[model samples]
Target: MIKCCNYDRKYPMAWDREDFSRAYRRLAPVYDHGLLLYELVGMRLRRYRREAVAGLHLQPGDTVVDLGCGTGVNLPLLLGAVGPTGRIIGVDLSPEMLEQAQRKIDAEDWCNVELVASDMVDYVFPPHVDAVLATLALATIPDYDSVIRTIASALPPGGRLANFEMTWPEAWPDWLVKLGAKLQQPFGVTTDLKDRKPARSIQRHFARCDSSERYFGAISFCIAIRQAGTGVNV
Candidate 1:
């Protein structure tokens, strides 16, 4: 049965690495094409990012890691928030996407940003980050629990994890949801998580979790933090 607020049919299945790799390689060239649809979605994500990061109360020189950074869209905002003294590390799996991000960094001459092309789920940072964010990338990863566990293990108590994902719309007519799902199939986009139990999976690693659905049924933002007794040490 589908959950009330969030329904996801994607969980019971997993996609292989080759499949994910191919998609990333293919998306490298036309990534911007799909992003046009996200103009409204982007605004919503930005708001959530700003709110979540600001709530972290970062100092002038705090550090943050952008998991699945994908062309570094959030790099500029993160740079401004963290200030010149702080650092922003962007991690992604696509080299082509990272190349575009690199060009942007060079063109803008942003000294506080660092881009790393690697699978965020497996990449290890020497020093733990103060905050971690993954915008819409979590939904694509097959290993949701492991990814959350990795992020939780890499942050200190009170460190924040802000995630933006595509969620199923609740209260919408069932026909609309079904129609949307059918429309996305041709493009290989799945709407299963719009109804999946992301919160339940999150709760396994985080002591506190809260979510907000925004953009009139297009996106979901989840903010989770490790609690004091969770034994999450930096």
Candidate 2:
């Protein structure tokens, strides 16, 4: 039975690291290609990813952290944003996913990038970070709100973070919402995901939060800003 698919639903499920880790480990090697295959579903993920990074407007020397950095698909686009002097910290709970990401780092000889195998809930933020990027990720973490708070306070004034994710349409009928949940089950998407609202958290923590939806409201991308320092530097 589907409850109302609004963002106000109570008691969403928590992140089950063991189960999701196993699923992602198995999917790690194919993850990069796997996302692209969603093209058949009319998701232009590559383009969306590029736009997500571009929204950060990171400078040549800024540091950025990528949470749930599966196979490091966002690394290249991030590298392009910050240039050679910037640092990237990619965090994930799946070692297999980190391994695939490491391969990308090695293949490109990216000396400034670091990959850590840790859940985003426990991952620590480094100082002097100018931005954070989480693409198709935050909704999967049960404690994403806490993470958002940490980023908000730790970032030097005006630091940026981008969230790009999958979501139900704004006004889906109950039957359609149920069908959508069923179709997403194989990818580990759950009904409780409907209750996760990272944007609201972002709005609560950051001084400025700007968001837009695309793909018929099935996708939301938000860029948030902390208070104090201006854009350009951290």
Candidate 3:
């Protein structure tokens, strides 16, 4: 279940936050199952998630914020990275989504996790947050630019942010890209996804941002470190 393809776009009208909220409300229960649709296309979801978590470079007892943490899909991986002593803060806008995540926590009997219902943009990063992660979540934001910058400003020294997301593929044939866009429409994704890339924003704030692309440019993974002194107050 991709909790994090958090959203934003240049054209604010592309997707209303309320609309996504409703979509997730209906999708909450079936979210994990629905993720199989990607696997059918060879998405290798678990592998990607593991790779993203590894990029965080977490240490035992380190804290991580899972932005747009849909249904807590990343919880186990994060908890594994930081161990029992470490803490995980999972945030999402959909209450129902959080409910589903809570169920998972209860079933697993994990005690170091916290779930918060809030939009990523207005989410207040608590003190000592070692890292922030947004998986499949950032592109959905209406102003990902500000969201990324604000998170950068809020992190302590050496803190990092890792964002993983999909985009309209540049390497695909024109006809294929169109077909892909149509398929994503039911999820409220528009042709605007082609312009939803946030790599530039990550590079702007971090002196060094590492990036990788997969699925022929349709998928991206980026990790940026907030240099000792960069960013303005959020």
Candidate 4:
């Protein structure tokens, strides 16, 4: 029998790091299949991933970091943009998720991609990354603000950051929003939808921020550019 992870009990306002890691461990094996509805039911989350990566405007031989990169869904896109000469550092908390990502790298014979199993909050940022991309993963991070600040500090001037994650829509009725949050609960999303606002946090760290909302405003894709002389010098 397949074991299911339970997260129904009360968690902190933000997810505990260990708790989040355990949750993704149980979900990793079937995680990609679980997202089929979003891909096939007109939601097309992959489109947002593509758009976000495109905003990076990467060149051959550039290095990029894929923060919270689950199952390497964003790898193919990143690989296409950076080419063989570039490097991709895919980071996640779950070893299981990173295992799945490793399989993809092996299958594609991609020598440039590296998988790092580490929490986003504590993971060391490599110097001079051309871009950082995270999709559908930021909302699950408990200390997302601090992570953004760290990214801002590590990136070179003019490095790009792109994030895509769930959002609570203002126009949606409270009942509908509640229902949506409930639907997403099993996937380890915070019960309170408002905590998923990465765009607002991104704006604070980045000088040029561009955002696009989709999926009835329940999803947001943001691309922000780190301006010269912004944040602490790393």
**Alpha-carbon local distance difference test for all models:** 0.70, 0.80, 0.82, 0.81
- The TM-score values for the models, in the order shown, are 0.79, 0.89, 0.89, 0.90
- List the candidate 4 regions with Cα displacement exceeding 4 Å: 1-12, 229-234
Q: Is candidate 1 or candidate 4 better by TM-score?
A: 4
- Report model 4's TM-score to 2 decimal places: 0.90
Model 4 worst lDDT run, 10 consecutive residues: 2-11
Candidate 4's displacement at residue 77, Å, is 0.6
Off by over 4 Å in 2: 1-15, 229-234
- Prediction 3 TM-score vs. true: 0.89
**lDDT tens digits, residues 205-226, model 1?**
7878887677775677778887
User: Native-vs-model 4 lDDT?
Assistant: 0.81
Clashes of each: 10, 0, 15, 0
Off by over 4 Å in 3: 1-13, 171-175, 229-234
